[model samples]
Target chain A: MTGGTAARGPLDGLVERVRRDPGAIGALFPAVGRTVGRGPGPSGDPDGILGPTVQDEARAALVSALAAALGDGAPDRLAEEVEALYRFGDAEEKRAVLRSLPVLPDGDAASRLTAGLLADALRGNDPRLIAAALGTPAAAALDDHAWRHGVLKCLFSDVPLDAVHGLGDRADAELGRMAAGYAAEREAAGRSVPDDARRLLSLTHGETEA
Target chain B: MRIFDPHVHMTSRTTDDYRRMYDAGVRALVEPAFWLGQPRTNPGSFHDYFDGLIGWERFRASRFGIRHHCAIALNPKEANDPRCAEVLRTLPRYLAKDGVVAVGEVGFDAMTADEEKAFAHQLSLAAEHGLPVLVHTPHRDKAAGTRRTLELVAASGIPPERVLVDHLNETTVDMVDDSGCTLGFSIYPDTKMEPERMVRILQRRGLDRVVVNSAADWGHSDPLATARTGEAMLRSGFTRDDVDRVLWRNPVEFFARSGRLLLQELAPYSGGAFAGNSILRAQHAEPDA
Candidate 1:
């Protein structure tokens, strides 16, 4: 559906339903796991399955299409749809909402309204939520300190840093310092520092290309 | 040293913790449905939480090569909330699901009339479903709460052997022991019960009809407390077989009463990209569906 996978029949069917009645997102969002699929691949990606599995992409695409359909006239409706799906939805549903945040109408207002949701996900131990929270443009709502802590969370939880959006641009000296401290703690505890943390340190030192 | 942590909240834990738990020899666990540290205003949230306990959390544990199981109930603290009472109606549906080893953590939090009412109701649900009950005694008023818990367990007409009275200490353990129900002790990092105290209790109590858990949740607790208690038993001159009896066999025998414990090895999560970030990678461009 996104860029050439098999069977767009179900995805196209969902898109038609949402376009006909945007309100259908509430029901359609949760059913994405069943309609789209978890994708076919080996799960052993070291980056951790804090995913937008290929199927998740299909679901997000459907959400984006709905947002574009609602357009400027119904930002509130879009917001309401996102909120309901996130609040009542499971981890997969929540991830889908987080994935579609950037594509929702009115980016600035959407970002502000969902900042608390982003913060809530960041505060949790679930690597899936943490990665989804930071992986989207919605994460821009997070301030410098919380953003740095999110990176630290990825390090602590072994979520690959590449999952974090805007890491190249946002990887500041403070984040580098935090990573160094975390590395020191891991070393002191006789634990190996994650390669991602070490890579983050190199970026801050301007010794390595992002 | 393969461990079956009878009670834990893996929903609040991380994959790293799962990996560590696996490394420490924990191959299976029963994550009881409990309060989320924040009160829910709607019964729907509990449904989602329960779904995660059975669906996603189960899969997550499988990814770590550990078999995960759960206990379904309206926990004691939340039973007082009339808003949460609606969830009790749905408890039967989940209790009938696979991997639901018991109806649990259901005894008392404040020993309130509301807590007692919900506790008694869930005990009946466990009885109806032929599932075991996991009773959590109040952290405060430990002795009185446990006594009332046993009295209600007796009143429910469910066999005492079908119940697990959790979170007992020196003061409460003897009574739960005498009640003929399985005794559950949660070994914490600092407070409640520590490794040495747990060892002393095992020494005095001898390990029959006993189970030890990390009871680790969103609090300062160890996921490896069961393994630590096993190590403590070894240092105290208990044989490995004795440690195995208490740490592994005892809890297995208790929860397996549900005939639902999945002990077979599952391949760790090897599939890439979960229900997670791949779509967010696209630059704000709405894909044409």
Candidate 2:
């Protein structure tokens, strides 16, 4: 204990990583990082310690997966892995796996995985996961069926602004920007923009009107 | 490691408080002009706040070798007071001066007609002077206020990319990212967003254009919250590169766009704390050198 306490450097991850093989964090996964008054969460597990460690692993795993997927001949083998990742892995594992899809060249496996993750997170009722899912900004990089679904799902999210952008609190700002674009497009296309939304958008053009 | 708190309001604090923060890992900070504890009596207090944000506070922070920068502006809350208009009038002079990175902490508050009026007017003025905006988010019912803030931004048509929305949280992240402007999260003790949560947000969205700030000002806040968040990011599997990117590089790149003075180009303040050195002045024709 004394040695571990005195020990420091980039290897701090390894110490926590050793704790991961036990499936302790994975077992208590969904409850990690939740607050009491916010709402329901994965019941009574105090995941503070495990939460950070698990997230770190998830990120490292994603980074690894992305690097791997970006490599050549990744298709034939990677295809099988993507399919299985969704069916088996839980949220953190699944998310890390999905994040890998971003750098993977658009193809059969990438398409299916992207669509699935986006649809699940954005369309589902889970706000926390959606917030977590968006940590991967691949939505900006995509244009395929999966990307389209993800973007649309953000618009429909229960906590639309809260869950979607998840970065720099620019979601509402982007929602306004996107809504305006849609309105302009509607105008050129000779369609009417939704009345209430347009009114709100008009008022929110830049900064909140008092 | 030594950490620099680039944004704070030490004017609301005492010198002893400064010593405490210094020991607590804050080596520097940026104190932007804000609405005083009570309403500003007049332009003089605003001037004093501006001066302190840039001068006395800078000197005070320097006593600890904690570099300080200032963002001069008429805070939104005080804008409704007709008596406070002169402060906004002084923007032109400060916008071009040193340590003034952006016309900031300037977006919206209250969602009041007067608030919006001041928001739009200041925004326009910032654009006219070609200064970047250090935006402020409303404290109450934030998501709604955040939406309204974005709406005005869209209407203004200032390149959304140049705006830095502050005090972001889970509720407002989606809105900020979608807006395509840079985002700043003030990781304070109780209010604003927390560091652990900020790391999660950072994890979901790779740090391309996001920044984490202490937003530590003259209230109950921390000067090294950014560094703490940085530490959290590291624990969360982000590399040193990622931590530095969110904590320093991204913000440095954004604030550098201010066109006032590149923070990187400024000469390093080399003397010891409280040394007799005055602030950097112009080197004239064959001086004592």
Candidate 3:
């Protein structure tokens, strides 16, 4: 596919493939192994470049295709598929499914259904998974309280502030207050506050400190 | 064993990294202009960054006896920001500077329309300025991004031989090789290709027009990765001549096209102070008179 077309239509061809033979989704697993484990030799892996590993790229492509194909279907049905993928998949696979949450049709319903997964991811120590959950378009669907907690979670976990999308737009008095409280607690314990936390707090007050 | 780490972000690195790199036989290096982790607000920020790359950063590297060169361009990730578009107008002046060698770290990130426009414009700038181009392929969607990069280079009318496409892995190597552009592999830690894997690639592909770099940036990366790769090559039964070809000769050949590459050994710093003043504020205290 041309670069122009690929950016414009990320799931265009993949949706048809998933719809035509949903059973073929299982094939992505082995393809992931073939592409990820060893070199593709001189021919090169056609499925490569979604990420560092073939597994990551394949999983991301498959999840995105499945989400798009099943967008208009019954909400519960789509949730079940996502749940199965999350449960049966590895850490990278789970990350792919979480990242696909935003691109799925019916953004509101998808965000609602995946809130638990996002919450679970935020509670984890894996920076990439947390980054995936926060960076997604679905992350925009987070309610004020959830979003505030997500920001705090990132600070407490040492994830970079850049991982949080629309940070400047979303900064508010409440987040600022929370960040100050976090900073004070770190100070009381004789620890330095994260640089991003300071940046986040500055953003709440509309100051360009960084 | 003298090496030229053709692509690295020494701005994000520490002076100790410079010391280690110098000790590892890295006599010269190039720090490409790249995203500074945070989104810069305007074109003025880019001008300041370019100035540092040419001025302060060069002096700092000279302290460690490493000749510092830099490539000036709007990085691909930031090209999409309209606020920074004015940088294109500001690039020609910096591109002509002494330590500047190429118009680089330029290519697709998200493959946005704005990115393509900036990339094409910079390629033209490289041709007009009589310099080589350093292209960074997207970390995500790398294959299609690389194909598009080559297509754009072909369209830009800059000969493929004058471009060095960096951050390539095993999957994208063949495409870059077939295109006749110089191949650049960033042997970074976890995210990019590893040293052992890089050795295997060199073993298979042979070190013709290939350059290996560390690309050590602000993130969790090792500045000594190029030296580590050289060590790996030797461990794998490759000759020191093979290591030298990939690490030094290939990069020298690529950047020499610009007529700006200075391969001469620079004199090491004679005085302990930088610019006639030491960072230490006071002399050692005399004990009780």
The weakest ten consecutive residues by lDDT in model 1 chain B span B277-286
Instruction: State the displacement of the C-alpha of residue A194, model 1, in Å, after optimal TM-score superposition.
Output: 42
Q: What's model 3's TM-score?
A: 0.60
TM accuracy, model 2: 0.52
Tens digits of per-residue lDDT for model 1 on B1-289? 8888999999989888899999988989999999886556569999999999988888788878899999999988778667678899988899999999999879876456778899988988988999999989865345667889999999999999999999877777888999999999898764357778888888887888999999999977889888998999899899989988988899999988999888987776444333552222353333441
Q: What is the TM-score of chain A in candidate 1?
A: 0.86
Off by over 4 Å in 3: A1-210, B272-289
Model 3 C-alpha lDDT versus the unseen true structure: 0.75
Candidate 2 lDDT (Cα, 0 to 1): 0.58
Instruction: Report residue B55 deviation for candidate 3 (angstroms).
Output: 0.2
In candidate 3, what are the lDDT values of residues B20-99, reduced to their tens digit? 88889999999999987645658999998998899778888887788899999998867866768788998999988898
Q: On residues B1-289, what C-alpha lDDT tens digit does candidate 2 reach at each position? A: 3444546777777666666766665554556677654455478877766766666667766654466677778787677566676677787877777878777777665455667888888789778877778889865446677888889888887898888888887767888999998888888775566778887887788788887777665566766677688778878898887776776667667767776543332223443333344333342222422
* Candidate 2 Cα deviation (angstroms), residue B196: 0.8
Best first by TM-score, ranked:
3, 1, 2
Q: Could you say which candidate leads in DockQ?
A: 3
Clash number for every model? 11, 42, 0
